[model samples]
Target: MKTFVLTALFVTIAGLSGCDRSSQGFSLPQGNAELGEQVFVKYQCLSCHTMAGYETDTENLPGSMETPVALGGQVSRIRTYPELVTSVINPSHRLAEGYEAESDQSVMPSFNDVMTVTELVNLVYFLEDHYELEPYPRTDYVSPH
Candidate 1:
């Protein structure tokens, strides 16, 4: 009875921990950020998004977004690996703030069919580099005697 209670509690905690990001309990191969950068460019991600140190060739874009989504910059919350993976694979799962009301489900196309798993892994590594997490205040614990 005690074990069952604990198990249920753990399951609930995991579900509530992340905002619609729970990896289906799996991991990918170690990735090379440099190769990931190449993948990012190859996919022409900058066509609809902005990132520091990267440029979009506006003149040659297949099509342009009415508004550009901004990627990696100073962030209050830490973006975890699983969250990033979900963001890339299932973009429509959670729409970015301002984009939620759009008629289109998602501006980002499905790359699951065209992009190799390795490229996905590598691209995650590359994107991780651009995120700058802001440090938070550390809690000073009071030891009870």
Candidate 2:
């Protein structure tokens, strides 16, 4: 009963905030976040997206989006590995809520032809490391007299 209540409360809070979470049966082996960072730079993901601690030189890059999309930070819920993988491989699956009007479709270009499987796994690992779940504030209740 206690677990159920807690979970229900958590879900309510999460729904009121920003979060991304989806998972399929598939799972990948644990990857190296360090190598993922290299892959991120190699692909120049910073041109249109920004992650914590990564430098931005979007202006210098040949093709850069006007407003860069932020990647990792405090989130209301866990960004499951499958969702992140899907996000990287098929960005069109879910468009960022507020930015849909900015572009007809996702501005992110396909890297399927160029990025290696190892790089994709590593990039997901790096992303998984960066997203921190925001602390949930417990709701208070008082019995009616």
Candidate 3:
């Protein structure tokens, strides 16, 4: 009976421990938006991404017939800080829907080697700040009876 009680206790502890703790107590450094914009320019991100209310001289870069990803606007949903961080650190984690089949690989180069942690945090802050929630359009159609 002692062995059975011990086994039950071990099972209960293991089950409780297995609960998700992936993001528990995790935190990123707070960043300054102004400095982040400088980081964006210094990294020449404007070559591919279009930032709302910001302009860059991209005339020298080769023009692509394809539309570049527009970074800021009234997005359908808010992008969390962690998502932005992951995008920078692991660009190919998941391709932004339509672009997946276009190329087997991500065109975005990982800045993990070039950027400091502080710069990354700040850039994410800047990008996240630009997105605003916009209401989805109401559907007019009703299900046929």
Candidate 4:
């Protein structure tokens, strides 16, 4: 009777511990960030979202989107690997700032179906490491009159 009670308690504790974690028991892949950068540009993610200050190498990759977007509240808030993965997989979950509206929708294409599991993990890491919402420069673009 004592052994049964102890086993039950152990099982209950393990189950409760798993419930508190939000990663759904998945681990990130070990892809090279340099390779991930190539994949990112090849996949054309640089077309819409701009990193805080780092400019895209346009000489090699001509015809890329030149306009820099303001990384506002929504972009600034994400600070974890899971958060970045969520943003990529489920873009509609958090709308980018200045783009929150029924009509001004997300231009970020749904790659959930296209990107492989490895690619997804690499992409998440790349984005998380490169662009940050906090400590992000908020330089305003001024149009010359």
Candidate 5:
């Protein structure tokens, strides 16, 4: 019962205050977050960051709120979309707070060469649309014609 209460409280707080998220990536997708879940799994993203609320049996995930290594648990410093995007593209740019600098040696693999631009955008949509975050400014990183 305590766990359930804690979880609900956390969700409520996260939703009310937001996750302090910001990004300079592509525009959010019109696709459903439910559909984006499919895109997320299809792209094999669970290998790294936790997909909040989403879970799977194959890997023994316990939802994002319970994940010990969730970004929220690690980095209170991050609060921007560009920061989030940089975390994805150039993961080596910043280490989440608390963990040692070399922690990346074991966590968050390099995706610079793996994910293509289109896939990156879709993945971002899956995150922004599906996950909750603290309020922050919005900025577009997509290039203009």
Candidate 6:
């Protein structure tokens, strides 16, 4: 009886919290791709991420890898708008496979502090436009001792 009461209380709280969230006035502005590109450059994103077909005059700092995370282009799966926002706001939330190191922390700095909400929304829109649906290639790998 005690366990059932606790579970019911928990569910009630969760449901109420969800209702509050919807009324929080959280909405993204309609994004402009042109402005987004300017934001991307202003933020120096190209220094770390490679966007397909997009070129930048800014060079990577010394000791930085020539190739970092590749965005845009043909992806095996499409990344949604929320995913892109989360990546910018909380980079370490999810790490791509094979990119993990000893620490789970992301090398990319969080843009939560630097970017405005409008810039973030526009950036996501710009990035989403670049992805193309492509089939993943099949390959077999042999372990090398």
Quantify all predictions' global Cα lDDT against the true fold: 0.78, 0.78, 0.73, 0.60, 0.51, 0.72
**Residue-by-residue lDDT tens digits, candidate 2, 42-62:** 988887777889887678443
Give Cα distance to truth, residue 54, candidate 4, Å.
4.8
TM-score winner among the candidates?
A: 2
* Candidate 4 clash pair list: 76-133
Worst 10 residues of 1 by lDDT: 18-27
Per-candidate TM-scores read 0.68, 0.70, 0.70, 0.54, 0.47, 0.66
Which scores greater on TM-score, model 1 or model 3? Answer: 3
Clashes per candidate (backbone, < 3 Å): 0, 0, 0, 1, 9, 0
Q: Please give, for residues 71-143, the per-residue lDDT of candidate 5 as tens digits.
A: 3322324444455566677766665554434545424556668676666655555565544443654676988
Q: Assess candidate 6 and give its lDDT.
A: 0.72
lDDT of 3 by residue, 1-145 (tens): 9999977865664456444323533346457788988888888878767778877446633343145568878887887778888888998888865555345566667799999999997898798888888878557898999
lDDT of 6 by residue, 82-104 (tens): 77778888888998765554578
Error of 4 at 86 (Å): 0.6
How many clashing pairs does model 6 include? 0
Q: Flag regions of model 5 displaced more than 4 Å.
A: 1-36, 56-68, 71-79, 101-106, 131-145
Candidate 3: where are CA atoms >4 Å away? 1-25, 60-65, 97-103, 143-145
Over 1-145, each residue of candidate 1 has an lDDT whose tens digit, in order, gives 9999977876675666453333646445567899999999999898878898878655544343556787898787767777889999999888876665457467688899999999998999798778988787567899898
**Candidate 6 deviant stretches above 4 angstroms:** 1-27, 56-66, 135-145
Candidate 4 weakest lDDT stretch, 10 residues: 64-73
lDDT of 2 at 28: 58
Error of 6 at 67 (Å): 2.8
